[model samples]
Target: MKVKELMTKKVLVLKPNNTFEEAAKLFIENGIDGAPVVDKDGKLISIITKTDLMKAILNKWKMNERIETLGPKKVTTINGEMNLEDVLKYKVSRLPIIDKNNKIIGIITQTDLINNLVEKITKKYRDLKNTKLSLMELDSVIECSYDGIYITDGEGNTIKVNNAYERITGLKKEAVLGRNMRELELEGFISQSATLLVLKNGETTTIQQEFNTGVKVLVSSNPIFDKSGKIIMVVTNVRDVTQLYELKEQLQRNKEITRKYVSEIEEMRTQLLNTSEIVAEDHRTIEIIQLANRIAKVDTTILMLGETGAGKDQIAKHIHKVSKRSKKQFIKVNCGAIPTSLIESEFFGYEKGAFTGANKEGKIGLFELASGGTIFLDEVGELPMDMQVKLLRVLQEMEVVRIGGTKSIKIDVRVLAATNRDLEEMIKKKQFREDLYYRLNVVPLYIPPLRERKQDIFPLINFFLTQLNKKYNFNKVFASDALNCLYEYNWPGNVRELKNIVERVVIMSEDDKIKRLDLPKNIIGSNGMVVTLNTFEEGINLKETLDSIEGKLIKKAYDKYGNVRAAAKSLGIDPSTFVRKRQKYINNIDAQYKT
Candidate 1:
């Protein structure tokens, strides 16, 4: 608080020429200990206190001596805006308050300072009381939280434990409270104490703490510090993730089962989806495949870019099958799917007895296995930094070195990388090496998303339909209305989502044809209605009809592609034209709405 709020007003002042006797009389009359001595212009000169007056009286000082001479020739005066902290730094009991004119405005005495301190202490007490009341109100929420909570002091002594903490750890609050984390750990109440770690290091820590009762909890401990940069408290949030881990394990098991089923189905479909005969009816798709074919003629690194489910894998496979090394082995590796710990051994084989549980006769790695062929690295952005360095070295040296072997074996293999992620962004973030990215991105090709290539959607749907019919011996067709919905709906998951939907419709439809009712709501509600030409009674206005057709095509493209640029690309029109036409239709809709 500012000193002005506590400084005493109506301050008694003495002229610089005032005698010691006059000062003493004024001090007694005002019942004050001190007063400011100022000159005729009302500017502060010095200060005289009761001690100075009494000392002068005993010594019988001369009357000619000015009151300013009694105490100090120069005195410290503070501005009204100065804070209490600044005031305390001065070692005097009485101080004069001054304004911009250097005139004495008021005085701060010892009694005033004491009173202000008492007021501050009372306010602090009230604030602390309010804080306690607020904490009491939120006690129920803390107890009801799904995650367990525990708080400890800087000394690692437990202060509070929530109900969830007791419930998850099977320990009573009484047993845990008043006992420090180290004590609890020694007693085997908790296998580990993250709170202790936070207290020691003063940093937030997350750890899995196991209890002697066989329950595992994920705990995150955060240290709260005071203004002095010292830890005052540690708050730990604990969650019983045993069930979560179990659920993840079950999901992995289900994923394995699904993988086996999909593998079998893909093996069967491989006979039909010949690498040389991939469906590429759209001009853009045909152009991309031709580029891939040219890149495949040689054995240089190739990078494929596209959205997930946009058939990046299909492009990689086509490149591998058409390359000069097509007669040799073709190995596909999903960099993201492998664990970081096992990725090195997976890429380069380990020698026999290299480490514990090593293969007796050693095993061949992907680089060794695909010595004379191509190895496709799918989702290559997930490679760790160390592995990226090793992979780059292998690429540059054209050889392989086993984990335990000292000698490098020379090899001849082509590398192809593909990722849905933006490797350029990853390179900027330092997550992916720029050198490795350049090596892999030697011949980069990007395949447009399914929505941008709507012309190819019907072809893909028909191909899946033919294959599904042949495999299941069913001749199912889609109705006109259903086909319209499928065309209007944007394929976010691209060809994979389209193929899955087609297969599901084929299997679920009881009738020979799939109707609008059989399609998913997303597809049916993608757009309000199919835009069709309406016949007029007299005749069609050529200009108006053409405008209407142009506007409808622009709107349809925008609806399917979700942007003017992609829509323009799909319709082979300029983005500006697409934007203008789309805006005209939007204005027409808005005007109709207002009316």
Candidate 2:
């Protein structure tokens, strides 16, 4: 080590112009006996001490006089780059340290070197003491161990055996110690020897051995190597595992029983889902429902994707009802319904008096209210960009910080988000964050539109009709022709539209039976196979009636073919004309149904 490493870098340097009183005050305040003196150009001149100051005081010298007049001009100094051993050769208690330019950089005292020497000596002593104790404890630990410990020489001669070995093998140390393992095995004292195997292979070995006394033991032998890579000794650990084998067989039986119980529980859950409000007669819908049920057992985020009124909300609620958190609260929030300016406060809540017109007791955010439960974010795609960042943080950290509050509240909430908008496309357009999209889309569930799952239409219609009849205290039924039209019509609005139509016909029909004529005009025009003069008996315009019929036929072809070119060809028209007529009809439909 060098002197610079041990020296104190912050050194007090006195100047020739400083008064004796000033030098004395610095020495007293800093708890130092001496300091280096420098000239005006900061060159080391000498060193001064309290003894020199006291001698000057005894001589009745003025306290305001310069300190340079009292201290000796000659002083000892050392270079910072010099070895630390050179410091010991000096007679002085304190030495001023200088750089290559002979300028004082630091100061070193004899006590610093002494203290460093003492620290090194103390550490070495502590290490030796710990090593000695460890070796003593190792021997005691081996002797007191529950498992048998047997040691043999490289030549397979028994060297030592702990009390546990004697007790487990039913052999005393006097009978086994110093005996060759081959002789013991040939004499019928043991069935086999793990130590002999280790000596032959020069590696660790294990085997099960049976003693003549009918005691069974499992032994593992590990070889100890010398510096020349030759085995010096083999240490064997013996354990009694006869009871362990029996316990393993019992454990296998228990696992089989547990599996049977799990299968029964799963069957019960499946039955519960079938009895719920979700109608899953179609194969694709049934598969989706099964997947939702399986994932509901855990706390994973699920994103429901489908067209508007496709029962996305119903699926989200179903997930919550079947989840582990079913007993807890299920809070639903429409991201699009909340105002953008107040979204942050509404999501993370706020402290009392956070802003103007705030509630006096503050408010709990949706996340906090749904802690230990579930939160369904409907229309999640409509969240603002800024709120998306905050939501991502909450999901990642599982905690939320309220507005105007410093403390972060921990929450255990499972998130289920549903959106009619395409979030992946929104990510490409820079409207949604890619990372947030991945978090919410851990499990993507797509609910098919009503047109795709026609098998479910009749069941859902009957369900709605029954519900409406019960509410109105009247019995209502749909005619066969009406049910056929509903099944054939391409429902653009999905389940929500079907429910509304069912309720409308049930209440407005003049008789108990709802016939095909009682259905909506749009539905009849779209699905009716034959147009009769009786259909116009209610007094319709000639031009409007003809235009409506033509538009419905074009739409029907487009729905069947699913492409502009093929749909137009089927109707004996050009693709361009098909596009034009489709756009016009869509506009007219929107205008006519604006209520």
Best by TM-score: 2
lDDT (0 to 1) per candidate = 0.71, 0.72
| TM-score, prediction 1 | 0.43
Worst 10 residues of 2 by lDDT: 52-61
lDDT of 2 by residue, 1-595 (tens): 4434535533344443445456546654665444444433324344444432212222332333343333333223334343344444432234333444544444433233233433533333244325454322554777899999987666777756778888888897767766789999899999998888898898999899889988888899998765567776788999987667668888998999999998986675477465457876777777777888899999999999998678888888888888889899999987755666788998999999988988989998999999999999987987878999999999999999988889999999999999877787779988889999999999999988989999899989988888888988878899999999999999887888888778777777989999999997878984434457666455546766677788888779866754455677898977667767765564443333334
Error of 2 at 246 (Å): 47
What's the lDDT for candidate 1?
0.71
Mark the regions of model 2 whose C-alpha exceeds 4 Å error after superposition: 1-275, 526-595
TM-score of 2: 0.45
| Predicted candidate 1 versus true structure: per-residue lDDT over 183-211, tens digit per residue | 99999988889999998887999999899
Q: What is candidate 1's CA lDDT for residue 477?
A: 88
For every model shown, what is its TM-score relative to the native structure? 0.43, 0.45
RMSD of 1: 32.1
List residue ranges in candidate 1 displaced over 4 A. 1-277, 526-595
Clash statistics: count for each candidate: 0, 0
